[model samples]
Target: MEGKEQNRQEGIPLQFCKNKTKRRDKSFNVYIKTFGCQMNKYDSEILEGLLKTRGFTLTPHIEYADIALFNTCSVREHAERRVYGQVNMLSPQICSLGKSKRGDNYPNKRIIGVIGCMAQAHKEKIFDRLPQVDLVCGPQNLYNIPDYLEDIAKNNKRILAVDRRERPVDRENFSFRNKRRYLTAYVTIMEGCNNFCSYCIVPFVRGREVSRPPSLIIKEIEVLIKKGAKEVTLLGQNVNSYGRDFNNGYNFIQLLKDIDKMHELRRLRFITSHPKDASDEMFIAMSKLPTVCESLHLPIQSGSDKILKSMNRKYTREDYLRKVDILRKLIPEVSLTTDIIVGFPNETDEDFAETIDIMKRVQFDTAYIFKYSPRPYTQAARLEDNVPKKVKEERHQELLRLQKNITLSNNKKLINRKVGVLVESADEKGDYLIGRSRTDKVVIFKGPKELIGKIVEVRIIDASLANLKGEWIRL
Candidate 1:
């Protein structure tokens, strides 16, 4: 939208996703089309958090919104395709928004632009397909959002704000409410990855790991809590590798210790840990921190040492096993979760067997198994996409089948245990509510609406592959 329409408007544009009463008619409402991981979700939330300060409200549906943003992910191939599809789906809205105000367009034209990884990878190419896209921003270019929006308001031309390199700071300090209603939130402590794992493009696409100063992260977490956040998961491509980019002594463990001291935080967690950086000190810190959740999402992409080396995962099977042993020994009751990339080029059945072996051995409480999708411009793409599609599917199904058994077995063990559950919302019948334990297991039980915002104890009566049935116990 142009500066003129923005200036002439009596009230903000239409808000499809925002709470109407709180939104000004003169402001714009934005719906984010996020396609990626928890980190992308966090980044989108941060963008909305900033937008809230500028009198913008967030919408849940994109088709009818005043502004549309696509938070893209490039971890796998299909993920990027999905982002493009989202942009195409919104084309009519973009054109209509553009057509309505052509002579004196509000110019926000709903300002459809792509951001995050896809924007980081495809950059200007996105515009070639969707020229109506007013601004294209990347994960690291988050701070430039306001400026890009401002530039579009004036010039009415497309602007792209994407950079793979880490830019130290860009948080505009907006409170993200509804994190459980605003419950669990992922807080990005650092941006980008330094590890150029042969199978990954994160390093080239996201640039090197640049840790947000510990103080900046702490301040961000404080704001999230004030807005009613109960839990936070510190985010980075490699969380344990945080602070290595600097000479400062503050590391991931130190950050955890500091955040753990926050009086308002009920639980804390982190993810996408690299086995290479899963340092001893971090494990000790996790065991000691009272508020730290008894769970970790360390991704073991492959279990065969040969595949590990081929993937350039840095750590071998023995190394990863040692780290797992350390975590188990130190945090005895810690619930373990992981990511498994099922098929890589040249993965033999024996290699596949090794991964299955680890699944049985770790008995991971949860596993997100996926067949590998070759992403463009990654080192892995340089190699032949040798794993047959059928084989990849079979490997993926086999892993899931194994994980289902593992999860059910672990959940069965939780039966009869009274655990702390942070009540999220009422069940469909209004007869029950749902929440997660510190271990991040989903638990369901009968409860009053009043229990929605508080953590309560629930006695487990039954279990399932994906969730648990429980009875809320009055404290």
Candidate 2:
């Protein structure tokens, strides 16, 4: 997933069908197995919206599904491998149905497809590997999935829709898809990335940066707010570089200011900001905006200048520190989270020490640490992956151990304090309700079922490296 964002269930309105009188048969079901970032989840929501319009309902059980879609990711080799394994596992069951013959029930024959980054990256090669795949669509072509699925059903042949052109999002089209009455929702303000980080495959698979029109974005948020969304998270590959593609003066900071004017909104958040593009003006806006949450997911891939430069990250260690210092000064109570990659090629013991040093200085509330893995067709792939697997594991464990101590220490201070939490869901065990604080910390507390979609004050009673145990104070 992009920047290690946790996956969550996206809501789809129960009455999304075009005709109010027409009831869905629930015979034909589409099962979407998403394996990527929040953007991919948004894409899956769009897919669900499109399918619901076409009279198909989503099903959790793949065995009973008429169509199974794998929304894939290529950020890491492991993600891709998982997709491959899933496809392979499902191929036999799909193939056993055989071709659609005369007088046969078309609904009985399953259709399997792959969408998103991995589909865009592999294209037809995906067919060569997984011959059972009936459709392969890219992220840009998601809106056209129903049409392609229709064509496949009519002709009984495979199809691919991986257009590279910049596609405009139809916010009005998917307005009814916000089914969740949760206080928080994700609004993708932009798509793709322009920064070609050497080890990253996002730019290649997701294409270049394209910011949605501000008017459309604001309108979408308004629709969401009207439907009971209290917080909106602006998503992008690099949110800080949102308006750079446009000739107009509209930028991310300006967008934030515009959204801040929406008094109905209680909080706003954004993610995956590149350190170099995180301007001081943006931090200032964040500090002043009452709706903007006091949390930032700024990913500093590495702390060693040599490793950063080699990864084409553009910012030096000191430059990132300066930005962090500025942000801390402006928002004293802000919670900082970061993404770190260990054992990059040519990194020495001293370089690893620099990463630990920076972690101590920054004291990030949470850190997502990943071991270096060279991606195909990326600049780093050409270089030798000289770091041994054992060494990488050691470095990863060391960083994780260090970050856990820091996180636990930091969280300990929150005990006996009160914080507002937006209740999202009950834990799997059903013993406690799980939600997030304004600072994005996971808080678990016992509460009524009615509190699932509302924000309430909670008093922290216990703390751990990963989450906080709290007691409900009030709604």
lDDT of each: 0.77, 0.82
Q: lDDT at 92 for candidate 1?
A: 32
Q: Which 10 consecutive residues of model 1 have the lowest summed lDDT? A: 1-10
What's model 2's TM-score? 0.90
The TM-score values for the models, in the order shown, are 0.88, 0.90
* Candidate 1 ranges beyond 4 A from true positions: 1-26, 93-110, 164-181
Candidate 2 Cα misplacement greater than 4 A, ranges:
1-27, 92-108, 168-172, 176-178, 428-431
lDDT tens digits, residue span 126-147, model 2: 8778876778888887877877
Among all candidates shown, the one with the greatest TM-score: 2
